[model samples]
Structures are given as C-alpha cells and as structure tokens.
Target: MVAGRSGNTQLVAALDRKASALGLYVGQPLANARAMVPALRVVAEDAPADAKLLARIADWCDRYTPFVALDPPRGLLLDVSGVGHLFDGEQALLDRIRAELRRQGFAVRGAMASTALAARALARHRDGCVVAPGDESKAVAPLPIEALDLDEPATHAFRRAGLKTIGQAAGRKRAELTARFGSRLVYMIDTALARANAPISPRRPLPDYRAERNFAEPVATEDIIRQTLLALAGALSELLEKRGEGARRLEAVFFRADGIVRRIAVEAGAPLREPNAMVRLFHEKLAALADPLDPGFGFDLIRLCADRIGRAEAEAQQLDSDAGRERELRLLVDRLAARFGRDRILAFHPCDTNIPEHAFALLPAQHAGPAERPWKKLRGAKEAPRRPLRLFARPERLGLLRAVDGRYHMRWRNTQRLLTRIEGPERIAMEWWRSAEPTRDYYRVEDENGRRFWLCRDAQSGQWSVQGGFA
Candidate 1:
C-alpha cells in the first residue's frame, strides 16, 4: 500500500491470488482492504529499490544475449533473433528464461511472437501466449484498447464511442481513426499487431568475436581457469589470423553459478594476434587488478570477446639484419607496455607545422610512426642538424648591443661575454594563422669561451634572447 493525494492511504499497487479472490483490486483503498480482511500485512513501496533490482536482473539476462532492454515500472525485453536456435527453439528458450527467473524468486511471465510489441502485449495479457506469424490481428483483437497505451483523453473517447476491445477499434475506418486522433493511435495498433516495424535497442556493444564455454559442473580452480582462457585466446587468435586482423582490446566475462557476473578487460598497445602473447597480456592485466577476481561458488560459464579490432598485415622475414633488429626492438617495447602500462612508454612524433614549438609531440610508442611529411630543409643543403640539441621551453632575455664592427657584446648574470663569430640570420616568421607573435631572426653564434649559442632578435621589438645551446 502507498500514500495517495491529500495524505490518504490508497489501494494496493500489487497483490497475489488470495487478495484477488477476496475482491481486492489494485489501486483500491488500503482502509477498504483492511476492512475487507481484518488481518492484513503491508509494506511501503520503494520505487528506487525495485528499479535497481530490475536493472540487475536485466544484467543477469546477458548470459542469454547482449540485447536486453528494460520496459520500466516492470518488464524486460530480450531480442533473441539469432540466439533462439542456440537453446533449441523459441518455445524452449522462453521456457528456459521463465524457469531461470522463477528459480531466482521472480514471478516471471514470458511470451514470444514475430514482433516485440505483440510479444509484450501477449506476455502481459495472456497466459502461456505464443502467437503464430500470421495470426497477430486475430490474437490482439480480444485485448482492450488500453493495451495500446493511449492518453487518458483518447481512451475515454474510445470508450464513449462504444469501443472497448481492440477489435472494435480495428473495425473502424483507418482514415477516420488517424484523422480524429492522429497517427500515434494507428501506429500503436499496427505495431501491437506486427503490422509496423519495432526495433530493439541493445544495452551493450556487440563484440567483434565471442567464444564461450559452458561447464556441466562449475569449476573454480585458478589453474584450470587460466588454461581455459589460454585455449580460448588460441582459438580467437587463429580466427583473427585467418581474417588478417588482430584485436586491440579483449574482455573476459565470468558468469558464476549464483547469478553473479565478473568482467576483466585488457587493452593492447598494438594490434595483437599471437596466442601466447595474448595470454601473457591477460595474465599481467589480471595480476594488476586492485581487487583480485574471486570465483565465488565457482563459475558455470566463461566467455572471451574481442571488443576492438584492427587490421594486421602478415610480415615476411626481413632479409636485412637491421630490419630484423628493429622488429625485435618493437616487440620488446610492446611486451614492456603490456606488463607495466601503455602510457609509460612513449616516442616523439613530428607534427606537420612550420612553428618550431609545434614541430613535434609525444605519443604512445606503439603508434608513433613517421609523420606524413618530413621536416623541410634549406634548399640545396646537405643533411645536418640545424636545431639546437637543447631548446629552452621559452627563450631567456639577454642584455646585448650590436657593436660598430657588426659584432655583439653582452653582460649576462654579471659576466661579460663577447661573440667572436656568427653563422646566420635564418629568419623565421611567426605563423600568422596560429599566433600574433613578432617574427624572429635566428643566429648561431660562438662566444669567446667557444660555447655555441642560438640567439634570436625579435624583428618587431628589436629585443635579443638566448633560445638554445649546442653541444
């Protein structure tokens, strides 16, 4: 029983066979119910708790199929299109679902039809309902107009016009009904009778590949579980190799005997296909979990799925020893990343831009391939390192003056420094599309102490600053 408007206690929201037999209906006043039955027990309604339990029940249904949706207030929809054959047939599958949910202390009602709306209506309104493919309109005719979920005004209008059952509404002119009440009513009836299309939305992403093992008796030993995972990985790897593709992310789901499910996931730094390598990565991932996986009461089923996939080209044995060495080095890096973490290992990638500060960026080592375009060099110049070995994040200002002899003199940090020789005025203008900073004229200068320094003069401000240093 729950509270109604004006703080008055209302009728029961739900009741069993005995209460119904005693002439008690849902939404009936609680005071009237107690008067009808002197000795009665009642509990407060908890909408949130009921919704949470329903969600968990929907999750448990994933062992059957990944496409499970909730029909709020109390209903669940499972689109078992291709999965029905796995459990023998549609009737047998429905029976299994009902039996399992009933065993878990739920009063479950199930029905199957060609359309979701028809199946839902049958499950709610009829017992043991299974509508044949072509018999939808006949089967739905007996149900009331309220089954279409029309608004209160429309339902009252239908009742006032002597339309009580679906048959009465369907017998009327389709054009008149659509014109009077809009297309929603017509669409609802069409959907309910399998005339219109209704699609199911899955709660989880469909995996690229999935493999499952169902044990006659639950098994919980760690060694056996690990072996099972390795076997599944081997099979999946073989499948991937045949398609010339590899998995970038994999997930393992352990469905326990007591209706509890646990999932462990691992991400690959690169496209991976080797059976042994995949197993090793999962081992490392499982070991690194903050909370160790517990196979409480054993697991009745285990499934391995490839969540993300990518193309993997089969490489021929390299003839050059250097190429072979590079391959080995990459393999080592992949192994290290698998054991520690992906972000812990990184490499610099050249960015396609003219600005010196935006020339390169750090990316994951596994994905750090050469840029689309190589860095442009000076025209007719030999390959040489022009940029300084160490560039400061920001240039430091220097108090310097150009002498009459075209030489530079500066006193930095209270120490006198003289430029004995200079190399260039490699002018680099600021990328106006990116920033409004002034242009700079860069020069490679050697001080009297033989230390090579990179200096720049801001063209707009005429200010000098030290940018970098050479070895």
Candidate 2:
C-alpha cells in the first residue's frame, strides 16, 4: 500500500488486492485507514519512480504497436486497430498482452472499442471487455455513472437526479446535459455512445519510414545482433532510395525479452542514404553508451526508424576532388558527433547583431540549419585584423596618467605601459530599438612590447576601459 499527501491530509494512494479485500480503499484519509486496520502496512509513495516505471511500460508496448499513449498514473492506451491481425486476432492480441505483462507481474486491465474514451471506460469498468464494431453503445450501457470518469460535482448531480448507470445519463437530451452539468458530460456521453471519437496523443512521433525484424527465438550473440542491424538498415535504405529521400535523424529501437526497450538515436550533418553510413553511426553511438546496453535474455525484436527525413537529390559525378573532400568532412562531423555528442561538436553561425559578444552563435553542427546572415569583416582581406582575438565579457576600467612625449599612457593590471601608436577612434552607436546605451569610441593601440590592446572610451561618462587584447 502507498500513502501520500492529498490537500492538507495524508491519504491512501494505492493498495493491492489484499488491501482491497480488507476494505481499505484509495483516497481514504490516512488516519481513518489506520484506525480501520491497526496493523495495516503502508509505504510512502514515490510519484517520480512510479511515473518512470509507467513510461518504461509504455516503451515496452512499442513492440506490440507503435501507437502507444500514456493515460497517466496507471493506465496505457494502445491503438492496435489495423495491427491486431498480426498477433492472430483482436482477442488473441489482448490476451497475449495481458498474459505477458501479468507474467512480468503487472496488474493488467485493458479494452478495445471504436473510440479511445469508450475503451478507457471499459478498461476501468469491464476490465477484459472487447466491444465489437457498432457495439460500444451496448457494451458501456450497463456500467455505472462513475465509469464516465466525470468530476465530483457532475457525478453527484447525476446521482442526485437518480441517474446511476452510464445508459441513464446518456439517455438525457444533449442540450439538457450541456445546459446543466456542462458540455464535458455531454461529450463524455457522446463518446461513450460512439457518436464521437476521441483521439489519443501518442507518446512519441510516428516515424516517416521504418523497418523491423522479429525473431522467433531471442538471440543474444553479438555477431547476430550486428547482422540484424545491418540487415534492417539495408532494408530501410532500399525504402529511402525508392522515394528519393534520405534521413537526417535516425533511431534504432531494441526490445529486450524481459520487457526492457533500449532506444539509440543518431543524427547526420546532411541527408544520409547509405546503409553503411547509417550503421556506422549506430555503432559509434553504442560504443559511447556509459551504461552499456544489457541484453538480459537477448532481444526479441529490433526496429529502425527514420524520424526526420529530407530529399536525397542525386549529385552529379564530379571531376574535382573538392566535392569528395566536402562529403568526407560531413561524414567525419557526423561520426565525431555520434561518439561524443551532438552539442559537443558545434559550428559558429552568424547572428544579425553588431554587439561583439552576440555576433556569432555556436550551434550543434550535426543538426544546425543555415544561418540567416553572413559574418561581417572588420578589415579587408590580407590586412591586419582590426578586432581583437579575445574579448572580455565586461571591460575593465583603466586609470589615465598624464603623458608628455611618449604619447598615450594608462595604468592597467597594476602596471603602466607606454603606448607607441594609436589608431582611429571608431565611433559605434547602440541600436535604437534596444535599451538605451551610451556610445563608445574604440581605439586599437600598440604597447611598448609590440602587444596590442583594444580600448574603448564611453562618450557619456568620459571613462576609458580595456575591452579586448590581441596579444
């Protein structure tokens, strides 16, 4: 049994069959529950761990069908509509799912119907009910009003009006229900009667293209897994080639026999259509996994999916080596990114900002799109760089010292350096649309030891500071 805080008081959150038989229901106040059974065993509820376990269970359901959605706290919805025949029939598919999950020690209860809401109601009330086509209305007609899963106020209103069963409440006119208990109750009735369909949002996006291999017997050998991956990648490549499209993001899903699903994803710098390249990325990703993929009892199923895709236009055979070199560079970036991480390998993309710190943005090279603007050069090609190589986040103030014949002089870093030369005072104004900022007069000055320093003077405050350094 589990107990947690609900409002200002601790309440019973969950309990097993034995607790249920003992008349300790969920949502009962903790004090009352303890009084009812003096020796009742209760443990604190860990919501995070429970949610994670539910998510893992949803991942495990992917082998049965890709259209799996979570139904919070303790329920899962699987849209196995057209895929039911693969597991023999609808009844067999449901039975197999229940049997497998029960074998793994999960209290399973599920149902199937035309609408998601109808199935949800049945799963909660009828448990193992399977409503045939055009039978949703009849199947859910006998369930109590609580099966509709309405709010407390709405449920009480229905009960007060002597509406006990779902059939009784659904019998009322739609306009009356909408005007009284509100549209939610009306919609629930509509869906329970199969007059409307409620869509279930899948936990993950549907892949554009997919290939899978299901084994009759679980295989644990390393060579066998490698061969299976290559085979699946080849099959997926053929499909991509037929459509003249390549994948930028690819994911490989491994379903372990013990209901554990391992998913590995890799991204390419450009559209990749070659099977060898795709498999190579997966190999690098697997090798870099901190927690190595454990094949407990081997994997019964392996699936490869192209999550993001782009056009794979045929490139003309080039006579020069430049094109080949470009392709090799892209492949290298992809491999390195897979081994390390996508964010670890980045490229500078120009931003449309005059501020030195905001001039360029470092984005992941593997998935970064083209930048909008080009990098503006401060000096002409072949000329000395006008901007400093290193810029400080915040300029450090410099103290001025009266100079005579040696030209400009300043006290910086607890030392005074004699300035040999000073360049033009480049005036820069802040953007008007942004917050008000003072104008700056920048100067490129060379010190006595041939070191250059970037200095800026505030026009408003008449203050001098070092902004950057070239040495």
Candidate 3:
C-alpha cells in the first residue's frame, strides 16, 4: 500500500489498494488537490532543513564506511565494497541502515547493488530488491523505465508508445533504442544494467589523516583540551612523517554532548609536521575565541583532520647574527596582532604609479612583508617625488584666507601653517562614469620648521587642504 497523504479519495483509495498508484500518474494539480478535499492540509517544502538532516545522516553512516556522499536533493550513495562483509552481507547492512533511520524518525528506503545506477533504480522503484554483484541487469529488468529519473515529457512519450518496463526497453536493439529515443535513454539503460559505470562525486574531499578520541566523560577546561590536542597533533605528525608529507591545514572538531560540533581551522604559511608548533598555533587561535567553551555536559568526541598535505621540506638555519633580531620582530608583530587584531598591524607595498597617493598600499602585517626592490628592472620604477611618510586616511579641508599669487595660506586644527613652496599644479581629471569626481592640482610644500607636506588645491572651488606630512 502507498502510505502517503492525499486529498482525492479516488487516488488515495487506489494507492491504498496498491492499484498502480504512480505518484506521477495522479495527474492532479495543487488547485485540484485543494478542491478535492477542503480539509486537506498543505505545507511548503523545507529544503535547507532537509539538506542539513541528510548531512547528519551521512555523518552517522560513516560507521558503515568512510566513502559516503549525498545523492543530492534526496538519497545517499555509500561505497560498501569490502566493508559489507563486516555487517554480515549487503542485505544485513541495508537492513541495519533502514532500521537505524526508522529509529531516528525518518521514512527511508534502501537498496544495495553492484553499481550506483542499479542501486538508485532499485531504491526508488524496487525498494526490497537486492541485486547481487553480477546480476544487476536481472534485478533492474522488471522495474518501470521511469525508475531512471527521466523527465516527465520523456516518460509520457515512452508510456504513450507502450514501452513501460525496463525489460521491454532492454529487449530492443541498442541501435534502435538510441535512434528512437536519443543517446541519453540508451546511456541510462546501459548504466542501470551495469554495462556503463556511473561515479559519484563527494561534496567534500576526503582528508589525508583523521584521528578521533572518544572521552569517557566530557571535559571543557582549556588546559585539558590543549593537552589532548597536543597528543593528537603528535600522533598526526608521526603519520605525516611516515608518509613523507606535511599538513598545510588542520581542522579540529569538538563534538559536544549537546550534539553541536565546533570546528577550528589552522593554516600554516608552510607545510608543517611539527607537533608542538601545530598545538601552539591552535592554542593561539583558541585564546582569541569570543564565546566561552562551555563544553555544557562535556565533549563526547574530538576529531582532528589534516586537510591539505604537501611534501615535507627541510630548512637550513641562517648563519647571520641578525637572525635573532628578525625572530624578535616577528614575535612582537604576532603578539600585537593577537591582542589588537591583525588589521591594526599594517605593512606598505609599492604600487606601479607616479602619483604620490597611489605610490604605496597598506596590507595586513601578517600576510605582507617589507617592500622589496625586485621590480627595479621595470621602467619608471624609481620612487616618485618624495611623499610624506604619514598620510591622513582622508584629506581634511581648511578655509583659506586668500590666494597670494596662486599660493594659498591656510589655518588648520586652530594652528597657523604656511605653504612656503609650491610645485606644478598637476591636474587630475575625474572618471565621470563614477559619481563624486574631483579635479585637484597637487603641490609639494615645506613649513618654516622644515616639515614637508603634500597639499592639493581643488581647482573648481579654489580650496586647499593638507593631504599628508613627512615625519
């Protein structure tokens, strides 16, 4: 019997009696569904919630095998090659999954076969059928052609021509089928019969090394978690060393008693296989978390995965005496970033431009280094007319008293600062496509006290402002 809710008494009674209740054959529209039964309740589909539930199910299915991927929108594809025997055969494994999902309040159907196509067909059309390794064709043969997940138009076309069962389609010559229905139908049939292979691509790639620890009791203290993480890092380092590789990224997952998983990821500048370094990096990251690690009742499981691996590289120690000074500088920057945020620490890199304002760019100190002269070979690579070491994030405007011979004198911050020298009034035209266009004539000037400043005159308004200062 088809155990599903329906508004129409005729369709529901027909489905209950197992009398060809093709869900596709109902031919009732939503408006019609409501007209048939005024008391019928309809609900919108919750796709995201369904997807998250499927992901949780896939994680639970990891006990069966590590190779599990979502069949998308619905269903899951599990690679149960050599692992099925551990559960006492494919049927037992399928039964186990079905029972477990049922216990978890899910209405599930399962099928096991030598190929994914056969399994998908059997699961959708013949739920109870279990196709042995070499008997995929025989198992799929009795099922309807619609089991192939064909489009509605194609299904209707096939049905109109009296080709219903897969066995009937299989009886026809491959050349005839391809000529009549196109290559897609032929390909689907071939794949379902195991004559062609269909592979499943996982959403997430498998990690290189995975280590898990299930605690007898939950622990929430940072000290204990750090110690446990150190141990896991040591074990992971050993694995990488044996493989002659190093991990570029490490992910630590803490599975709490409440069933929520918290993940922390660490990325290394270089591939790393040092246990202490890995633990230290994670410790630094953990110390920066805003939320307290409440561990609630306690964490049940802790899993560490090395995601990206690369060939291990050997480093040679520098003989220069300045090595210690470099290390001290790095340590200072790391501490400042840890406390004040990495954005607060900045480095400057030269840009390819003659304009003083565009001569350099600011970048995060953690990811940027001192500007180098590697591009010295490029034409016009020389530094532009000396720019101020300190530039305001934005130019501050000042009300000028007067323009003496095209030289403006101004008062800023309630202090009198004179523009002693002036250079060419270099006009920068605006890109009109974008709004707020500005035309400015810039000048390099020095105050009486030998302080150099970069000032610009707004040509349109005849207003002057100090853009930057040389420290």
The lDDT leader among the candidates is 2
**Predicted structure 3: clash tally:** 0
Cand. 3 TM to true fold: 0.73
For all candidates, the clash counts are 1, 0, 0
Which regions of candidate 3 deviate over 4 angstroms?
Answer: 1-39, 55-68, 79-99, 125-132, 157-164, 214-225, 255-260, 290-301, 316-346, 364-385, 403-408, 413-452, 458-463
Q: What are the per-residue Cα lDDT tens digits for candidate 1 across 266-380?
A: 7775677877777777788778777878888899888889989999888666856886677666666666676677787888777877666567777878777656676565435
At residue 11, give the lDDT of candidate 3.
32
lDDT for 112 in candidate 1 is 80
* Tens-digit lDDT string for candidate 2 (1-471): 899998899999999999989999988999999999999898999999999999999999999888999988888989998987998989889888888999999999988888888988898988777889899889988889988878888889889999999998888888888899878778878888799878889999999999999999998887888889889889999999899999899999999998889999999989888888899998999899999888899999999999999998866645558987777778899999999998899988988877665677789887677787776898888988888988888899997666866477878999999888788698888777885888878888898999899999889998999999985
Q: How far is 179's C-alpha from truth in model 3 (Å)?
A: 2.4
- Location of the lowest summed lDDT over 10 successive residues in candidate 2: 312-321
Superposition TM-score, candidate 2 onto the true structure? 0.87
Give the RMSD in angstroms, all C-alphas superposed, for model 3.
6.1
Each model's C-alpha lDDT? 0.80, 0.88, 0.73
